[model samples]
Target: MKVIDLRSDTVTTPTEAMRKAMYDAEVGDDNAHEDPTVNHLEDLVCALLGKEAAILTASGTMSNLVAALAHTNRGDEVIMGSKAHMFWNEAGGVSTLGGVQVQLVPNDKGGRIDPADVEAAIRPDDVHAPRTSLVCLENTHNQCNGSVLTNEDMKAVADVAHAHGLPVHVDGARIFNAAVALEMPAHELCKDVDDVGFCLSKGLSAPVGSMLCGSADFIEEARRWRKIVGGSMRQAGVIAAAGVVAVETMIDRMVEDHAHARRLAEGLSHIPGINVDPDDFQTNIVFVGVDPNTGSTEEFTDRMKEEGVLTAYRGGGRFRLVTHREVGAEDIDTAVDRIAKVASEMRNAR
Candidate 1:
């Protein structure tokens, strides 16, 4: 049986080119900031994001945590989307470790917080409330079918946050994917924001790593947080090498993954119990609502997995099918057919 893993883009395997680059990497004590390859990756991230400096981290979560810690002091506050991964997925490290208060604003269906809402969330400096120090946003929002936020859309939030002397941090884990969908430069999407972080592992097909980019002073501070969190890696150039190659070659190919996601969305939309708007399938994630009239979400997911179409069940009768370098459009089509047949048979038997 052919297995198509669409659980997430994180499931993607590194390309042969990426592997070759990793094999040839010159690794050293990155903990001391002396690893040449790691330095190069950071430089690449800075150049790509139009930032003054960058620091490589183990994962997007660590990058986000470091960015948050750097942006806010203990007892500070952050404004973010209620649906963002930082709020729902991450282990709440920002609050537990930094003693930062998270003020969440409701996210619209498009996976964006209104600028007006963000403005209202900022606290007044009366010594009564935790100072609002940061505003964070996610691109290709995982919880919302990988919605792409336009540069203007981001600027609106940035404008509101900056007006109150708050720094904006974009959790751009899938920044390249958003850039491709919007037909704009990835840097442009995040340039207006005060700080940004992006994952090299996802869509880029790198084995591991993410980078936090910002002003030189901010990166200096973030480095201290990196060490405190034990994220300071030694001889990490081997991983950074792959990230460099991912930035150089892997970005443009994400369009193919987007196509595959769209293909899967289209197929799911035709099924009676799977409610998905194929047109909203941007980037590489397809979100489908499973109707209980046919079968429970659990039953649908289990059946699909049994048929070798591996995916994840998002809550509220929603399921996520992500496209990646490891899987292609044909795989999407096959998974869709298998799912439709299983769903049809399951409903008939019921």
Candidate 2:
């Protein structure tokens, strides 16, 4: 039996070059800002995102925490979409650690947050209200079926934040996918925002690391927060070597993953018990719902596990299967057959 794992892009294996780079990488203490490879990777990421500087973090969650702590003071508010990765997925680090309030605004299906909602969320000049200091947005929003927030939409929301004297932060974990889908450069997507954190470990296929990027002043603050969070490391360039390879080689190959996602989403639509909208999907992540009357998410997911496919399940009976460097067109075709069979069995049982 062959196993196909479509759970998330996080499941991807590092490229051979990435592995070789890790072995062949130059090393030094990075906590002291002395690792040559890490410095090179940071410079590359800063240029890629068009920011004045960048800091490498251990994970996307750490990247967000660093950004949050840097951009806001205690008891301040960070405005963002309800479905944003930091707001929903992270374990309340900002609120729990920094006393920063997360003011979640409604997210449109297309990954755009309404500018008016942002304006409404900002607090007035009252001593009692928590100051809205930052606005966060996601590129190819995770829960929105990888919907790309357009540059125009981003500028609209950014204008609202800028007018209110709020800095904008973008959780760009899947930003490369957004750039590829739009046929534009990644920096173009980050141009309107004040800062962004793009993951090297996801579609880029690095073994570990994400970059927190912004103006030099902002990065200085984030660096302090990184130290506070214990994200500061020495000789991290060993792993950063893979990250360098990811940025250099992995970005342009993401178009194939997006294509596989489209193919999988189309195939899932043909299964009777699954629910999805092809038009709403734009990147590597696909969300499909199992009919409650037919089967629950656990039942469907567990059954698929038996058939050698895996995915992440969530509330509302939805499951996500993401395509990445490891999962290909043939993998898509095989998973479609497995999913169709599972859906049919569950439908027949009903």
Candidate 3:
């Protein structure tokens, strides 16, 4: 049986075309800004995100950390959503390495942080509070069932931040997914923010790389910070070449992944012992809630693994299922059937 891996889109394999591009890539030292393929990929991200310049990083986490370091001085506060990936998942690099403070605003179920709350959270510079230097947001927010933040949603917060003399950075790891679901261009989606970063490895299906886009000065500073964090790569065009192919070809296919996710969520909602609402899923991630009568989320995940389906338990009786390019409609159907069977057995055991 073919294992249907629904843990995350980060597990996607690169396309054959991407492999060919990587193998045939022209190379030079990226640290010297001489890698032609990396230069091209940076230019593509700049154009795609409507930024004056861009820089390449090894991962989305590095990109976000670089952005934070570039935008804030030590001891300055960075405001963001409470459920943001940077805060919850980035190992506190900004706080630990950059000496920055994190101030969180509540994110709604749809992944929007209220502008009023953002404005209210900004410190008054009374010498007792840390100065608010930056605001961060996540598009297709990971913990929020892949919910998308509209440009207006971003702009509202941006306006508040800008008025307070603060810059905004968007952790756009799955930004293309947001653009596809919103039917908006990537440039338009990110225009309001001072900096935005996206992963080429996730929904785009590239083997590795993330791109950070911003103004020329900002990118220059971010590049310096990236080097400080040991993110500078020599002769990195091998992977950057695949990133070029990813930006050129893989963005449009995210719509299919989003559809598959919705199908899986809808099907899971119908299954016994699982609690899910199809309407809660907008992009490629579905959060499956286990009822009290059902088995533990970990137990269910292990049982699904035995049945040739892999999933992730995201704490609190919720299991996350993400759809990617590798898994198609048939795979989703098979996964749903097997999962429902497992749920039935678990309920019976209970």
Per-model TM-score versus the true fold: 0.98, 0.98, 0.99
Model 1, 1-350: lDDT tens per residue? Answer: 99999898888778888899889999899989999999999988888888999999999999999999999999999999999999988899999999998999999877889999999898998878889999999997989779998888899999998888889998999999999999888788788888888999998989899989999999999999999999999989999999999999999988899888888888888998678899887889888888888787888898888899887855688788889988867887889899899879887887
lDDT of 1 at 287: 84
Tens digits of per-residue lDDT for model 2, 229-346 = 9999989999999999999998999999989999999988888888977776888999998889778999899999999999984667898989998877888999999989998998
Candidate 2 residue spans exceeding 4 A from truth: none
Window of ten residues with lowest summed lDDT in model 1: 310-319
Per-residue lDDT of 189-228 in model 3, one digit per residue for the tens?
Answer: 8888898999999989999999999999999999899999
As a whole number from 0 to 100, the lDDT of residue 28 in candidate 3 is 98
Poorest 10 consecutive residues by lDDT, candidate 2: 312-321
Give the Å shift of residue 104 in candidate 1.
Answer: 0.7
- Candidates sorted by lDDT, best first: 3, 2, 1
Prediction RMSDs, each to the true structure: 1.0, 0.9, 0.8
**Among all candidates shown, the one with the greatest lDDT:** 3
Candidate with more favorable, higher lDDT: 1 or 3: 3
**Candidate 3 lDDT for residue 336:** 94
